[model samples]
Target: MKSALIILALSFIATFSNAQKKVLPVTNVTTGKEIYAKHCMTCHQVDGVGAQNMIPPLIKTDYVLGDKKRLIKIILNGLKGDLDVNGDMYSGEMPSQALLKDDEIAAALTYVRKSFGNSASAVTIKDVRRVRAANKTISK
Candidate 1:
């Protein structure tokens, strides 16, 4: 009976391990990077360092480190205000990214958040959709 119980436990563990591995669907970081290069890298720069006193830098920027909700809004709707990033005042007009799909925004944001020495949770399409929806409702 004890041997049977041990075998059952082992089987359960094996199943759990397999399930964990299967949880993550295939992610194409290359595609995400390509999108960023075409859309974002021009302003944000390849290394995420924006022009000094002009475009705000994404690497170690307070905008990325502060509130996640605010960042989502900025990505979706664009930002136009005076933002102090790393003790430097950055006031610029960032065009709205509403044209991009939610999934594209998620991928770009996720790439930005993960790259350039910044580590954070992955941004999901659902997150982008929720924020965009909330913005629309608030504007109306």
Candidate 2:
């Protein structure tokens, strides 16, 4: 009986420890939401409608709906100059969030891609890490 109890206790402890392990808590959607809140919300607004012609809306925009890779690159590297969004030209520089950790960037991008009526595959930390490493090489 004592041996059985000991085994049970060990199993419980193992289970608890496993549960506590930190392994990218945020899903792509959640990560995107977090990123939006932390970074994009100020300009894009909580409802995804930007300030008239200033920021440009994230909801149902061609920029968000089109080209996944381009979107990913934009998030990873930032956008600049003039760009067309739903028939309007948005001319501004989106500063690089290069300082953000790879996972964070991935989470944010994932959230953005999945949120605001945009649906796409989740962005993995690995994907962000790869892009960051590539950019680092180019910048150097």
* Top model number, lDDT: 1
lDDT of 2 by residue, 2-65 (tens): 9999999999999888888655345456666777799878888986878776788887776676
**After best superposition, candidate 1 residue 119: deviation in angstroms?**
0.9
On TM-score, the leading prediction is: 1
Predicted candidate 1 versus true structure: per-residue lDDT over 1-140, tens digit per residue: 99999999999999999999765432346656877898999999998988999998888776676567788898777888898888889889999888987778778888888888887777777788889899999876
Worst 10 residues of 1 by lDDT: 23-32
In TM-score terms, candidate 2 sits at 0.74
- Give the TM-scores of the predictions, in the order they appear: 0.77, 0.74
Where is model 2 poorest over a 10-residue stretch in terms of lDDT? 22-31
lDDT of 2 at 81: 86
